[model samples]
Target: MNTDRLIAVLAADAAPVGPHVVEWRIASALSIAACGAVALLLLSYGVRADLAALVATPIFWAKLAFALTMAGAALVATARLSRPGVAVGRVWAALVVPAAIALPVALVVLWLAPRDARAALLLGNTWRTCSLNIALLSVPGLIAILAVVRSLAPTRLHLAGAMAGLFAGAIGTAAYCLRCPETSVPFWATWYLLGIAIPTLVGALVAKKALRW
Candidate 1:
């Protein structure tokens, strides 16, 4: 084929792309997913009975801040992943910083308590259920996120899926916070993180097949 003719053919078939479009697409999809998750949570587990009192405590807000901040970071990462030729760079720092800060703080909180009380801090009554619930809640958000990512030109499919999963997990964790009665930072830092990790791992594994254009 002549060079000019080949170039023209390629250009014609290329997908249209724009700056920051990924952010909006993923955000819109996740917002819809959040509504679905909330409805599911309400219908299934219902909100905590002491929600009003829990909201008054500092720990409650701290737990939310950890999850929401992770969501924001993952969203940024997913946005970067959705586009080709984009350098993720320090955007990953947003994810690392919160966990780095909170985990140590949680450990300290546990250490300062009486030795016998440490187990309670680590394993709260819901440890077995917490991660599973977070993963389950993340399903709707994960599907929504993958839909948006699949529409884009993500070069790193696995990373894109992982970030999307992280985003979904964080959102799910935040929603779970409303129903969770545990007040220990150690419990949240451990179990909640495990919850987020489950989907992240799954996303990484399935991205090649699921995100193919």
Candidate 2:
């Protein structure tokens, strides 16, 4: 290679990546994973048998993965929005992609699961229980996260929001487990899926609006 070209290539390769982006990504991933794991653990181990199945099944795992991924994307978008030159529309568009992918996947997975499995999945009673639980768990955390973001301008608001939702879902699941009589895997699976989905949807909506600069 020519000397000038070699120097230019080295400079490009040695360029410093932004620390904020790295911190944002790591924080987002860890926050979501930790919150989701803690919630699921509590529901599965601390709560009754009815709650034990909350984390069971491919569908639940898939949704968790999807929700966390979206949450990460939302955080990235939020960080971008905080920058002076970035466009809000672009950030919003990027944040929406995960939901677009997850909604269809959720539909198909739920539709394809065996009838008994579908039954186990909570649509009516479990759905209602989980929704209430999610709301209770999420509300306070959401307030705290929004406050922190407002004051400190952390780039991980989306991650914080996701953790809040996951914690809420877990606590909510624990509450529902105490009240629920159903112990079957299918019931827990169904209801748990709903629980995760509801918060994920709500988080996405919040991110769309709140993450805007």
Candidate 3:
């Protein structure tokens, strides 16, 4: 009841948290939410009917590579930002490398395509809904990741939130690939990028208030 007694009780209840705990928490939260996002996508959009045929295509793998690589990089950034006083450092390179490789390849592919096909490559059939679908699928992840970060010790609220958003958005885009029938490199590079960007921007905007300790 008294100050001295309360101090003793607090000391007795405290336990030392190891570094592995942090990794496990973030990894588990993201993984679980990713599964949910995929399920949500499946329920709403259904898997592409020709997924088996698409699997053998290079473009399918390329699409996965883009989203997965982005997610991996964002995971690193999110991990670093979850802790106080941690610098992002070369995680920026990890994040940029995917775009650096994918964008150039996309541009080259666009250049060589027939003029008429160029429009399809950029817009695809679902251009109106592609980014929106990805963003919607990411809701589960965004909520879960933010909850985990809030429970941890993040000092850079805005940056931390933005990184979390990017991570979730990447994962969402990856899930959306299962439903997306688009075969254009340019479309992935542009529309998928926008999907992830939407969440990242939203995260940064909300982090200051939502992540405030």
Candidate 4:
């Protein structure tokens, strides 16, 4: 076909697209995964017995805030990455903000604590299982997030995967909080962060093949 003819045919095939619904789709997937995760939590690790009494404490909310904040940031980044060539301006900063805020606070808390107690602050009794549990809990959410991302056109496959993992990990941590007895910010900053990193690394490694179109 002639160049002009090919151009005309291509133009004729173009159609107007509707508003994007990436958030809704991702939310639906995450919601489904969250339900499964909740079930897992109920069966394997029920909520802390003192949840009712701890509800009024600032530390409890702090734990929730850390997870939710990172989840929000990761969600924004994942949405921006769903499109091709879109600049996710400062969206990644959201991920860093939580750590930035938490680090300083953790530092201060440690500074104010007695030298003998610093070790306990850093490694709570559940240190051996904390990160592992977070990573394990993230499995369902990771599957959901990856499935949602797979349906989209992501040029940066690895990054999209990592962001999805971040979202999943945070959600998992939040769920784990229901049973997590540790209330130390330092512990959350260290171990919880490691748990989230596990999925992020896995996503980055597998996304190349999984997201290949």
C-alpha lDDT of all candidate models, in order:
0.88, 0.49, 0.91, 0.87
**lDDT (Cα) of model 3:** 0.91
- Writing each residue's lDDT as its tens digit, candidate 1 over 1-213 gives 999999999899798667767668987977966886787789889999999999999999999999999998888888888888888889888899778988999989987999999999999999999999999988888888888988887889999999988988999899999998798899999999999999898888888988889
Q: In candidate 2, what residue range of length 10 has the lowest lDDT sum?
A: 145-154
Tens digit of per-residue lDDT, candidate 4, span 63-164? 889998998888888878878988878977778998999889889989999999999999989999999988888888888888888887899999999988
Q: Which candidate comes out best when scored by lDDT?
A: 3
TM-scores for all candidates?
0.93, 0.45, 0.93, 0.91
Error of 2 at 196 (Å): 8.5
RMSD of each: 1.8, 10.6, 2.4, 2.2
Q: Candidate 1 — which pairs collide?
A: none
Look at candidate 1 and tell me the lDDT of residue 16: 65
Please count the clashing residue pairs in each candidate, in the order shown: 0, 5, 0, 0
lDDT of 1 at 72: 86
- Rank by lDDT (best first): 3, 1, 4, 2
**Regions of model 3 farther than 4 Å from truth:** 1-12
Worst 10 residues of 3 by lDDT: 28-37
Give the Å shift of residue 27 in candidate 3. Answer: 1.3
User: Which prediction has more favorable TM-score, 1 or 2?
Assistant: 1
Deviating ranges (above 4 Å) for candidate 4: 1-18
Model 2 regions more than 4 Å off: 1-56, 83-85, 88-91, 105-124, 152-213
- Candidate 2: count the clashes: 5
lDDT of 3 by residue, 125-191 (tens): 9999999999999889998998888878799999999999999999999999899989888998999
